[model samples]
Each structure stands twice: as C-alpha cells, then as structure tokens.
Target: MIPLRALLYRRGTPVMTLLIITVNVLCFLFEMAQPFYLRESFIARYALIPDQPHALTFISSMFLHGSLLHILGNMWFLWVFGSHIEDAMGPAKFLLFYLISGIASAFVQFIVYFGSPIPTIGASGAIAGVMGAFLVLYPRVRVVTLIFVVIFVTTVDIPAAFMLIYWFAIQLLSGLGSLASISNAQGIAWFAHVGGFLAGILLIRLFREKRARYQYR
Candidate 1:
C-alpha cells in the first residue's frame, strides 16, 4: 500500500519537512549527475558498510540513494508523515530527532551485520521513525493509501496507528526472514527500519516526559 497523505492537521507550519524533502531531492540530483562508475564509487564510499566504522559515513549514507525509486519512495513517506511530527516537536527538535533516529538505525543494522559486506543507504529508516512518532502522537489520524490488487486500484482511509503497525510488522518479519537465510541478499535494511521506529517511539516518550514536567512548572 502506498500512503498518499495523512488527515491530521497541525497548528503551525512544517518547515522542517519541506527542508528534508528539498535536501533529499538535491542529493538525488547530485547522484544522477555522476557517471555510472563514479556514482557506484560514491555510494560505496558514502553508504554505510558494515565493517567500516567511519564516523561521517553514518550521516552521509542517509542522504545517498541507490536509485531514483529508492529516494522517491523514502521522500514520499517523509513528506506524508513527517510534517505532523515536525509540527508537534518544532523544527529544531524535529531535525535533531530525525538525525538521531537515522544514526541509531544505522548503528543497529551495523551490529546485526557486523561481518557482512553489504552497503546500506537511503532515508527509509528515518522516515519509518517519523511514522512511529506519528503513530503515537496522532493515532486517530487517517491516512489515504493506495491499494492495488489485480487490476483494481482503490484508495482507502486507514488509521495512522494501524498503518504504522502494519508497516513495522512487515519490516520485522522481513528482517527475521533475512536472518534465517544463509545469504543476506534481500538488498533491504529491514533491521534499520525496525531500529529507527523503536528509537522514535522511545524518544517520543522521553519528549513527552519533559513536556509534562515543563507544563507543571
């Protein structure tokens, strides 16, 4: 199912969400400009490799993409779900939360595939984190999803919580399946999505606690 947008409305503007989309688009354009061999080399160097603990790659890899579809898919989800989360947390906190979730997601994936030589890249993990936060903060919000079965295309309204939980379950199941396979060649970082979603949930709880204390002051 492809999520088009959410029905939730925020009181303020979503500047951070727009900025993130712009950055991802610009990064994808840069990737497209490079020659084939150079682009591959760029992805290998910047994308997170399990064995390489290069500090900068963790941040850089999140902005890089393997293909047009990969970046577009991630950006689509971010644009749909990230705005409400950013509005709730404010731009500064939202940006920090996003980067932290991405970093945490990469860390967990690296731990899982410590000996493997595959390269992990893209912003899906971080976008999954945004979905997690939205699930908690706006459970009643409705999402417009495109469902294509056979030749029929239908648009359905689903609760944010249900949509996110289903997405999380798919990632978890895929990750588990990858673990069982002798060769981890799924070409997707399911574990990163799992980790990022969990990080976002935990961070939201922490933020709520702080907000509560501030309100009581």
Candidate 2:
C-alpha cells in the first residue's frame, strides 16, 4: 500500500518537513550529476559500509541514494508523514531527532550485518522513524493509501497506527528471513527500518510531553 496523504492537520506550518524534502531532492540531483566513477567514489566515502572504521559515514550515508526510485520512495514517505512529526516536535527538535534516528539505524544495521561487505545508504530509515512518531502522535489520523491488487486499484482510509505497525512488521519479517537465508541483496536495509522505528517509539514520550507543554502555553 502506498500512502498518499494523512487526514489529520497540524496547527502550525511544517517548515522543517519542506526544508528536509528540498535537501533530499538537491542531494539526489547532485548524485545524478556525478559520473559513474565519481558516484561510486562518493558512495564509498559517504555510504555506511559495515567494515568501515569511520563513524561519520553512518550519518552521511542516510542522505545518499543508489537510484532515482530509491530517493523518490524515501522522500515520498518523508513528505507524507514528516510534516505532522515536525509540527509535533518543532523544527530544531525534529531535525535532531531525525539525525539521531538515522545514526541509530545505521548502528543497528551494522550490528545485524557485521560480517557482510555491503554498503547501506538511503533516508528510508529516518523517514520510517518519522512515520513511527506520527503513529504515536496521531494514532487515529486517517491515512489515504492506494492498494493496487492486480488490475484493480483501490484507495482506502486506514488508521496511521495500523499502517505503521503493519509496515514495521513487514520489515522485521523480511529482515529475519534475509538473515536466515544469508541473502546478500544490494538494497533494502530492513534492520535500519526496524531500529529507527523502535527508537521513534522509545522517543515518543519526549515528543508528546513537549507538544503538550506547547499546547498549554
């Protein structure tokens, strides 16, 4: 199911979400401009390779993308769920939380595939965290999702919490299956999604309290 938008609205402008989307798009454009060799060089330097000793790559790799679809998919989720999350946490805190989630995601993925030599890159993990925050902040919010089964395309209104929980479950199942099979897929860091999602759930209390305080003022 592809989420088109959420029914719930925030009280304030979502400046942080717009800025993040712009940055991700700009980064994708930069990646597109580089030559094949240069692109590989950039990914090698920035993307989080499990064996790499440098810690900065964990943060840098989140902004990197392997393909247009990869970046677009990540940005789509960020745009769909990030606005409400930013509204809840406010700009500064939202940005900090995003980076922290991405870092945590990278750490978990590294641990999951410590023996593997694949490079993990993309903002999906951070965006998944944002979705998790949204699930906690607006569990009853309605998500407009498009489900395409065979030739029939139907749009359904689903609760944000249900959609997010289902998504997390899929990621967890896929990650476990991959590990069991010892498969080396080029993309899709399921463990990163799992990690970021768990972190977001753990951090929901801080966000909720802050929002409540702001609402009282």
lDDT of 1 at 95: 91
lDDT of 1 by residue, 1-217 (tens): 9999877656567898899889988998998899988988888889898877788988888998878889889988998888777767778888988998899999888888886778899998888788888777777778899999999999999887888899999999989888977265549999999999999888876443243211100
Once fitted onto the true fold, the runs of candidate 2 whose alpha carbons sit more than 4 angstroms away are 212-217
lDDT string for model 2 (1-217, tens) is 9999888666787898888888888887898799978888887888898877478988888988888888888888998888777877778888988888888888899898886778899998888778777777788778899999999999999988899999999999989888875556546899999999888888867765453322310
Poorest 10 consecutive residues of model 2 by lDDT? 208-217
- Every candidate's lDDT: 0.83, 0.83
RMSD in angstroms, all models?
Answer: 3.8, 2.7
Error of 1 at 66 (Å): 1.0
Residue 179 local lDDT, model 2: 83
The most accurate candidate by TM-score is 2
For all candidates, the clash counts are 0, 0
